[model samples]
Target: MQIQLEFPAALATVLGMRGLLIDGGGTLRETFRRIADEYPKLGLHLFDESGGLREHVLCFWNGTNTRWLPSLDVAMTEGDELVIMQAASGG
Candidate 1:
């Protein structure tokens, strides 16, 4: 199955803002790992040494936050749309 990936903000600098077609047929974990393999930079920003999402970034799929799901373990199917967005904060 092919999934649609969209990157936002600084994240988009690494992977332009648009739909990226990705093949995902394995477990979600494996699929994410595959994405990392394809774009090593995104993985760097997505995780820290402690293994948590960076405070500056968040992920959403089809208008729903992935934080509510298992994230890397969330199952993916064809035509699934994902967005990698940077969280906003200001004083």
Candidate 2:
């Protein structure tokens, strides 16, 4: 399967592109693990020391927040889209 991943500009600087087409078929967690393997720097920004997604990092899986999903083990399909962003903060 080929999944589409979109990143914010700041993260894109690390990825060298705002969007990426990843080839593989697996659960969401596995796919992210693959990305981390390929881009360690970007992984730092996306995952915490425990390998879980950082609190401030928001990932939308096909427009629905991945956090809202039942599990990160949700299977990914061809053409699935994932949009990653940093949650806004401060007043």
Candidate achieving the largest TM-score = 2
TM-score for candidate 2: 0.90
Tens digit per residue, CA lDDT, model 1, 3-58: 87777656667666544788877656666677777877777877666555667767
Model 2 global lDDT (CA atoms, 0 to 1)? 0.88
Shift in Å, residue 8, candidate 1: 1.4
RMSD in Å for all candidates: 2.5, 1.3
lDDT of 2 by residue, 63-91 (tens): 99998988899889988999998899887
Give the poorly placed runs of model 2, Cα more than 4 Å off: none
Clashing pairs in 2: none
Best by lDDT: 2
Model 1 spans > 4 angstroms off: 15-19, 50-52, 70-72
Error of 2 at 41 (Å): 1.9
